[model samples]
Target: MCCYVGCVSETAIESIRRSTRVMLLFTELTAVLPIFFLLQERRPWAVLGLLMAGVVAIIVIRVRGTLLRLRGLWEPYSYARVYGLVAAAMGIAVLAAVTGSQTGVFTAILVGITASEFFVARPLGVASRHVGIVVALQSAAFWIVVVSTGHGDMVGPTLIGTIIMTSGLAYSVGLTYRWWEGVLKLEQARRDAAELATTRERLRLAEDLHDILGHALEVVSLKSELAVRLTDPEKSKAEMIEVQRLARNALRDVRALAHGNRRTDFGTELTGARGLLDSAGIACDFDADPTALTTSERDLFGRVLREAMTNALRHADPRSCTVSLAVTPDQATLRIVNDGVAPLQRDGEGSGLAGLARRVEASGGSFTARAVEPASFEVIASLPR
Candidate 1:
C-alpha cells in the first residue's frame, strides 16, 4: 500500500497553486477598499485616490505577468518588465508620501508590500531573504507615517500587525511552493526510471531474438543457394529438406519468444521434474504414459506439470512428491501430491496459480489445488482428449 502523502500529477498541483494566488489577490483587493471610501471625503484626497487606483491597477496587472513568468508560462525576458513595473509603483508611493498626500501614501504602502510578495515567486535563498528585508522596511515606514499623521488611532494597532503577519505568511507560502516543486521533481524522476527499465528489457529481448534466429536464417540461405547450384536431383532434394527443418525450428523459436513461454513436451517436463526434485532433496515417484495422450494433450499436460513442480518447490518444504498422469479414451488426468505443505498466506491463490487455472479452464479442463492433509498438498488437472 502507498503511504499517506498521496500521489498527484504536476499539472494538478500547478492548477491548485494558481487558484490559491488568485484568491489571495481578491482578498487583498477587498482589504484595500476602505481606503477608497475614506478618499471621497476631500477633493485632494479624492484626486490622489483616483491616481493611486490607476497605479494599483497597473501593479496588479504586472503582478499577474510576474506570476506567469515565475511559473514558466512566459519567457524569462518578461521578468525584467515586471521588475520595472514593481520599481515604478514603489517610486510613485514614495512620491505620494513626500507630497504629504496621506491617502496617496497609504495606497503606495499597500502596493509596495504586495510588490514585495511577488519576490516569493523567485528562486529561494538570497532573493527571498532580500525581499523579506524590503517588506520589513516598508512596513516600518508605513507605521511611522501613520503615527506622524495622527491617524494611528484611526487604523489601530492592527495596522503594523497586519504588515508583519503578511510578510510571514508570504514567506511560508514561498517555502511551501518550493517543497511542492521538489515533490514534482521526484515524481518525474520515478517516471524516468520506470521508462529506462522498460527500454532495457526490450533491448535484452531484441538481443535474444537476434541470437536465436540470425544463425539459422544464414544457414538456410546458404543451403538454398547451394541447392540452386546443384546438378543432382537427390542432392537438391536433401538441401531443400534441411532448409525446411531450419525454417520450422526458426519459426518455433520466434513463437516461443513472442509468447514468453517455451512449448515443452511431457517427456521433457518429467525429466526436468525429477532433476529438480532430486536437487531440492525431495524424493519423487513419477508414473506417466506420454504415448497415450495426443500431441495437444501432451502440450497442455506439459505446462500443468511445469507449474505444479514450480509451486511445490517454491511454496512447500516437501520431503516427498508423487506425480502421475493417466490417459483414458475421452480425457487425460494429471495429479501432483507433495508432503510438507505450508499454510497459504493470503485468502486466494497467487497470480501464477490463478493464471494457470484460467488457462486450463479455457481449454475445457478442470483444475484444483488444496491441502489434502494437514501436512500434504495436492494439485490435479483434467483436460478433454
Candidate 2:
C-alpha cells in the first residue's frame, strides 16, 4: 500500500521502506507481462486493463505509505484506530467502484493490501477497543462488497483471516507488557523490606550500649567514697587503686558504647556528665576543652559521662557534685566529684559499667574512680585523641 514514508517508528519505517520497493517492482512486473503477451495476441483491451491495474496498484502503495506515516505520528491508541478505520474504508470504497471492471481483480488486490497493511502496522486492539471495532467493521464491509460484486472468488476469504490473525497478535503482546510491569513492582517491594531491616538493627545496637554502661558508673562512685574515708595510708592507697581500676573499666565500657568497635571521646563526656548530675540536684561543676578530639571522640566521652551522671542521681545521695573536663593534644579527660558516700554494705552494681569499660578501652582510653576526702567520691576518664 502507498503511505507517507517520513513518520514511522524505526521498526515500522524499515518495514514500510522495504515493502515499498518490493511492491513497486511487483506492480511493474504485472504491468509489463500483459503488454508482452496479450498485445501480440491482439488483445489491446486486456493490455490496457493490465496496465491500468498496475497503475492502480502503484497508486494504492503510495497512499498506504502516506497513511503509514500518519499512523506513526499519531499517539499509539489514536494511531491504531485511525489507521484501521482508514484502511478499511479505502478497501471497501475501491472494491465497490471496480465491481464490474476488468480491473475488478486489481481492486480486490488493493483491498487485500490495505486490509493487511492495517493489521501489519497497527493490528486490531493495539490501541483500544475502538481499533478493534474499526478493523472488524472494515473487514466485514469488504467481505460484503466482495460477495455482492462476485469478486469473492478471486479475493478468497483473506479479509476475514487477516482480521482474526492481527487481533490475536495484538492481544498477546499487550498481555506480555502487563506481566513485565508486575515483575518490576515485586522487585521494588523487596528493596523496601531490606531497608527496613537495616534501620531496626541500628536502633537495637544503640539501645544496648546505653543500658550496659549506665550501670557500671554507679558502682565506681560508691567504692571511691569508701576509700576516701579510710584513715590508714596503706588502706587508703589500696582503696584508691581499686577506685582507679574501676574508673578505667568504666571508661573502657564507654568506648565500646560510642564506637561499638573502638574509639571514645573524653571532653564532651565531662560536659554531659555535669549536666546530668546537676539536673538531679547533685550540683555538678565541670570544665573541659575538646579542641584536640574529633567530633566522634568528643561524643564517645560524653556518653560515658552521661552514664556516670545517671548512676549518681539514681543511686547515691550527695550534697554537691563537681565535674571537670580537660583536653590536650594527646589526651582527653573527665572527672566527676560528688560529696557524700554510698554505703559499703552492698557490692557496687556494675550493670552499665562493664559495657562502658569494654567500649572505652577498645578505643585506647582509660577510666579511674577514687575517694578524695572524708565525704567525696570522684570518677575520671581519659582517652587518646
Candidate 3:
C-alpha cells in the first residue's frame, strides 16, 4: 500500500492501479493452479471450468489499460471493484469445489476479500468503521458455520483461531488507512496557507505603489500650475525644476513597485534622503553602519526611513533633521528627531506615523513617535530578534 494518501496525483494513482492489477492477476493464477492439477484425475470438467474462470479473471484485471483510454467512466475505484468481484468469484468457486467436504477455508477467503474492498474503494474515515463491523460479523458467522459442517479434516479449535486472526488483520488494515487519510488533509492545508500568504503580499505591494505615485503626481501637477502663473523667469525655472524632480522620483518608486522585490539598500535610501532634504532647504544628517540584514528586517527599516524622510520634508519644516541607526546584540534601533516640530502637528491627522507604529508592533517590535520637548518631535523603532 502507498503511504501517501490525501494528495495523490492522477499519475501516481494510475501507476498504483497498474501495478495492483498485475499483482492481483499473478496471485489469482497461483492460488487456482493447485486446484487445477489436484482435481484433474477426479473431475476433469471441473478442473477445466476453474481454469477458464481464472483466465477470465486475469483478463478482466488487465483490462484497465483499455479503460484508461476512455473518459470519466474510468477511475481507480472502478478497476478496484473489478478486482474485488474477481476475488469474490474465486472464493465462491473454491467453496463449490469442496462444499460437501469442507467449507471453512473458502468461507474465510470470501469474507476477507469482500471486507477489504470497502477500504480500497471508499475513503478511510467513515468506511474504516463500517468495514470493521462487517468483517467482525462475517468472521463470527464463518466460525459458527464451520462448526456445523462437522469436517474432521479441519480441527474445531483451529477454525476458531483462524477466525480470530482474520478479524484482527481486517481491523488493523482499516486503522492504518485512517492514519494515511489524515496526512493527506494536512498536506492540502499547508498548500492553502502558502497561497494565501502570496496573495496578501501582492495586495500590500499594490497599495504601497498607489500611495507613493499618487502623492508624487499630485505635487508635480501643483508645481506645473504654479509655474504658469509666475511672472519671474527665475522662479518659474525653479518650479519647473522641482516638477521634473518629482517626476523622476515617481518613476523610481514605480519601478520598485513593479518589481515587487522587498529588498532595501539602507545606504541608497540615505543618499536619496540627503538629496530630498537638501532640495527642500532642510539640513539632513544620516548615520548607519554597513552590514548584511535579513530581507524582512531590511524592508521594515526601509519603510520607517522613507516615512521619516517624507514627514521631515513635507510637514516638520525643521531647519535640521537627524536620522540614526543603532545595532546591538538583541535588537536593531532607528531614531529620527527634528527640532522646532510642533507637538500638535506631530500628533495631527495628516501624519502617517500612527500606521507605521501599528506595523512595527505587529512585527514584534516597538514604535514611539511623539513630541519630547515644546518644539521637538521624535520617532523611534526598536526591532528585536
Best by lDDT: 1
True lDDT of residue 114, candidate 1: 44
The sequence of per-residue lDDT tens digits that candidate 3 reaches over residues 307-361 is 6766655566578888888888789898888876766664553335665676689
Off by over 4 Å in 3: 1-104, 113-136, 152-194, 207-215, 218-232, 256-263, 274-299, 308-324, 337-379
Residues 166-219, candidate 1: write the lDDT tens digits: 455445544544444454455556567657768856864664455345435655
Per-candidate local distance difference test:
0.62, 0.52, 0.57
Candidate 3 collision pairs:
6-184
Residue-by-residue lDDT tens digits, candidate 2, 156-201: 5556444553444334433332333333333334445556667755
For model 1, the local distance difference test gives 0.62
lDDT of 2: 0.52
Best-fitting candidate, scored by TM-score: 3
Whole-model lDDT for model 3 versus the true structure? 0.57
User: Of the pair 1 and 3, which is ahead by TM-score?
Assistant: 3
Q: What local lDDT does model 2 show for residue 163?
A: 58
Candidate 1 residue 116 Cα shift, in angstroms, is: 5.9
Sorted on TM-score, highest at the top, how do the candidates line up?
Answer: 3, 1, 2
Once fitted onto the true fold, the runs of candidate 2 whose alpha carbons sit more than 4 angstroms away are: 1-279, 290-292, 343-349, 370-372
